[model samples]
Target: MSMQITLRRARPSDAEAFERMMNRPEVHAGLMQLPYTTADFWRARLAEPGGPAVAELHLVAEVGGEMAGSAGEDPVGPAVRRRHAMMLGISVAPEWQRRGVGSALMAALCEYADRWLGVLRLELTVYVDNAPAIALYRKYGFEHEGTHRAYALRDGVYVDAHAMARLHPNPPRPSPG
Candidate 1:
């Protein structure tokens, strides 16, 4: 039997499950997350205000009524010139890794960025050792631009990361006079 996956905007009510998923040993190992993330932290983050101007999107994936994964996009910075660019982050439960959960989350994020938000650039960094994640991102059109040496510390050792990005495949065209 196949699992049914659903995607929706994350809510404060999902704080507990979100925290659990992010803190899982296998899950946090691949992400930049530190151990012991609290439910309160996720609650506050999920409840943060957003609007048309904010352009922030956080989505959770559910399967069999359980949190399977989450993905999001945040503006690269506060500068007006950077409005067209957003950074992406995603995480899937260890059991859900090989499933389509990650793909579903990526599809929704890309759709929102390209169609509704008028975003032209989506970017992310992944540790070079994470081949599965790198393949997934490439499947979604992310191209590696460069590498960052000692980008972050994980397990008391510095790790390198690949800077990947995807530009809008079909940017809007201005009306002809």
Candidate 2:
């Protein structure tokens, strides 16, 4: 049976669940990270401040009331000129793959970036072999910027990654002083 998925901003209380989901072999492998994520790290990330001035958004996807996936978007740099672009990261549980959880998380993040935060560019990097994630980003208008060889080390082997980005079609107006 199919499960319903919902997207919401992540909370500090979700640290433990986030830690568990991210450490899974399949999910962590896709993200090119060692299985060393800690709950305290997630808690600190979730508790950080974010709003119009700084559009850091950490989002979670829930399936049947359980955390199924997570995504985050934050400025690529802190300089004034670089605030228009944001970097993205996402991960979905093994059981949640092929479902709508990833899609929902992407949609929410893009919406927040384009409509709410007025961000002009959204960027992310995915392992070259992660076809499902690459396809999902393409569906959201992200294009391949280029490839980085030996960009990440996974299980003692270097892997290539594709840089992808989406430009907002109609950005929101900046807040006036």
Top candidate by TM-score: 1
What is the lDDT, from 0 to 100, of the residue 123 in candidate 1? 98
CA error at residue 48 for candidate 2, angstroms: 2.5
C-alpha root-mean-square deviation, each candidate: 1.2, 2.5
Residue range 1-177, candidate 2, lDDT tens digits? 867888888999999998899888898999956697899997997888776577688888988889999999989987989878999999999888888888899989988888777889999999999999999999999999999999999988999999999999787765799
- Give candidate 1's TM-score: 0.96
The CA-based lDDT of model 1 is what? 0.93
Report residue 84 deviation for candidate 2 (angstroms). Answer: 0.7
Model 1, backbone clash pairs (residues 3+ apart or across chains), number:
0
Badly placed stretches (over 4 Å) of model 1 are: 175-177
The TM-scores, one per candidate, come to 0.96, 0.92
TM-score for candidate 2, residues paired by index: 0.92
Per-structure clash totals for the candidates: 0, 0
List clashing residue pairs in candidate 2.
none
The global Cα lDDT (0 to 1) of model 2 is 0.89
